[model samples]
Target: MTAPLWGAVPLQADEWRFGLWAPSAADVALRLDGTLHPMTRGPDGAWQVSCPARANLPYMFRVDGTDYPDPASRLQVDGPEGPSLTVDPSQFDWGSHWQGRPFEEAVIFELHIGTFTTEGTFEAATHRLADLAAMGVTVIELMPVSQFSGARGWGYDGVLIRAPQPDYGSPDAMRTFVRTAQELGMAVLLDLVMNHFGPFGNLLPAYVPEMFSDRATPWGAAIDFARPQVQAFFHEAAMGWLHDYRLDGFRFDAVHQIRDGRDQKVMRDLARDLRASAPDRPLHLICEDERNLPSLRENGYDAEWNDDWHNALHVALTGEHQGYYSRFANAPFDHLARAMARGQVDEGQPSPEEPRGAPSAHLPWTAFINSNLTHDQVGNRAHGERLISLVGETPARVIHAALLLMPFVPMLFMGEEEGSTAPFHFFCDPPDDDSCEAVRKGRRAELAGIGYEVDGMLDPCGEAAFDVSRPYPAEDADRAAAWRDLTRRLIDLRMAHIVPLLRSGKIGDGTVSRPTARSFDAAWRFEGGTLRVCLALGTPLGAVEGTPIFTMGDLARDAFALHVEITS
Candidate 1:
């Protein structure tokens, strides 16, 4: 037993120092290399021990005679229930001369790395970085990569916070990924889940009760961010990703679930601490807050996932209102206008999901990331339907144009730009047979009452679910090409005409009245310029006088959209 700080600390090629936060334990021991080494306790109730770290070495902390994986494990072998391994962070050489892209000039592409490429590895996904960069994507927001239990799962169930999923290769794989992405002029932001750990192999409760709180989130447990040591654990997680991984940003998952019963808000404190971690390099701290509050930006988030905007636009375009989609059921177009005019809608209004949400007053459009489709909006549905599938192709394109034309920053879910036929279903690999059965039941029950999809229709734990979730090459060549062409033109139009005016705060108050039953003539004041956006719902729009800056399809057709920079 010896004195050392928390986490796996490498001393030499073979020797390593290990520590664990086990305040509630009466005794602690390091179980590794087929031997039990007694650990010494620190003043702050941490247990420390030193041991050998080899490629074959598997280790665990035995506190009060119960063995558990290290809470702050940097790398894990086998899985979360498996042993923690020592990782050497000094070997990798990160790229140089790159700061993160600001939200003001960002076009985010959110992807599930496991399903982004055929091989589903970080190394394999690196092959497509150039393709994305060429498509005008500025930031690549990766779905979580933490070590969840089993052969395959979406990373939200991860138990090991610092370690990359073994299924996706090692830590160096991620290091190489970040370095290569930075070199390719694309910034990578990792999605991290701190609200709760997965159902299986989560060891914090055994080590100490203070690690978690009595409060619970929709997933399961809520972490005790109010506690000093617990807060430090998460703070280190943020610092490790920025300073160690050399990543551009962190997309904190479901921040609305984090409960801190204290004056020093955990999120603000964590953000300030993260900002201080790497002063030389720029880093963004984004949040996924369902509450749609503007104050979160003040708390340190660069931007938030604007579900309200999506909900409003989705109901308006598709007219399929069910489950969480019902919030915008009453007057969808009005909500859409509110979202465009103020960057948010239904502020302080009571709804099914939340009791009351804070008004998003004076929030810059850039502060809200607008998109027609997101992981939750598409994947969390009962059947995991894509936006294009939910609505007709023409309506989807019109909505896409409307989404990109908004003053807010734009994002695309994986395969959305290419219009791939594959669906991103809510799929996960459960650890055991009973657990798998439980998962299927839970998933069915969740959607059953909502009337999105009836029970026993889709199984989240099935391999078929993952099979359908994988992104493939775009379906039909000519249709794919047309969609691709439309995407390029819309992005070009946005970057050239709309984005500049938006950043300058010239794109002001906008309105959308039902011009016809199947058409909308929407226009936003561009200060000194006039920009008219017509989403005809495949309904014919009349010819414009000046050369229209951008048109998705023939101006005579109503389904396609037409965007004209009114110069008169």
Candidate 2:
């Protein structure tokens, strides 16, 4: 493993070096396994102490009398408030071989580790990977596993950016999870948060306050990425995760909030460095940037979460236009058509909600990862209602089939394919401080502002929120099996038809035409042939001319059909 700028690094069998960066502190000391040792301070406020390599030894840095956990900690044996533990990442055996699959062939399944299984540990989650693989999920995107305060969280509010949450088992267990997925011919993509650190257990502001700019994000203070130290800090974390655990890639959370003023942006640097780190392996870098900047794809991003597609589809299917969904409320079908053909709905279009995005028609369809539902769409709601609850089973099933056959890459939230109706509430367990109350009030206000009735909303900080949010596959075993069967068949069809067209990576900008008010025909030309999809909601679809791949509902009723026409 490459030695990180900070954290516990093992050099030799008998030598373990611990380092901390605290330029603001007058003095810094390393307390290793209950033993206090004075560290040597260098010219750059970098303090280092070389001790005997002791794995699992509890350690913390005492900066000017107060003890603080390592910001780059790999494992917090007793949560974020406690001392960090020393770990040798090379200790885990990866077993045989796994090189990972290409991003084009990806069928992403986004799962939150804490709620994905009853055990909520990496070990437990690893056991269920084969099930997902069998369902034709090629990529498993784990929501952030970074250690936060307390136990339960969406992982966006992670404090220790490098450490794996103690609730999710050891660092080696996470490694084993990745290896297990790879063995099943599946890649693991971690949702990484580098925009801002969580409110609790963060020691950066306590010591190095200059790391943050005066500007603040909705979550917290904006990280000052212009500073060389800050850039290197995030870089080390990204590279460390890539090398230490052999993770295939990362889906950077809310990169639109990553305000980097410098030409050498930290996000771009992260992608470049990670790509260079693993030239042989297909390392996918996806981002959730609301800006819809085409430059992200031009730079190094494999794909951007197509919120336009989801928003338009949601507004059409459910007719709930609150907050961001309001942007697509007017002419929802038109927005859906644009998203289906051009990859983005608000492509340089006038919108009062947000600034217009660049034209994305030139982008390959695979560059847009489209999904009907995601964690944000479900969890951000006051009650966290799944699509099935909002729009009924038939409409949801029709849309789900269309999502799989679309030219864009497809993603499924956990239990989405299984048609699980369990709500994915925005859950977190922070300290019982002002932050807890702030979270409660903030959520209430946000939901109220979005036109949701917030009085009966579930308390995000309560244990009940997390408990009821878990997807229960056993609750309706037969129905879930049917949903799984349908999903597997759709995925199997996608693999045999759509994936082959996408593999060439040479696809033309698609065309869209409204056959009826609620029905639209969209098609994209690839090297092999043209992939066509006609989705009709409460309207009859016109006769389609091609080899039928999949069809749902009757032609004279609400329906969705996908076809492939080979060019002579």
Top candidate when judged by TM-score against the true structure: 2
Over 4 Å off, model 1: 1-5, 11-17, 32-37, 49-57, 349-355, 502-532, 537-547, 554-560, 564-568
> Candidate 2: what lDDT?
0.85
Go through the candidates in order and give the C-alpha RMSD of each one to the true structure.
3.2, 1.9
The superposed Cα distance between candidate 2 and the true structure at residue 520, in angstroms, equals 1.2
Candidate 1 weakest ten by summed lDDT = 1-10
Model 1 TM? 0.91
TM-scores, all models, native as reference: 0.91, 0.96
What lDDT is obtained when candidate 1 is compared to the true structure?
Answer: 0.76
Q: Could you give me the TM-score of model 2 versus the true structure?
A: 0.96
The candidate 2 region of ten consecutive residues with least summed lDDT is: 559-568
lDDT on C-alpha atoms for all candidate structures: 0.76, 0.85
For candidate 1, write residues 39-125 as lDDT tens digits: 998788878877777644678888788888888888887778767876678777774767766566678899888888878998998
Q: Clash number for every model?
A: 5, 0
lDDT of 2 by residue, 13-72 (tens): 878988877777898899988888899877877788898867888998998998888888
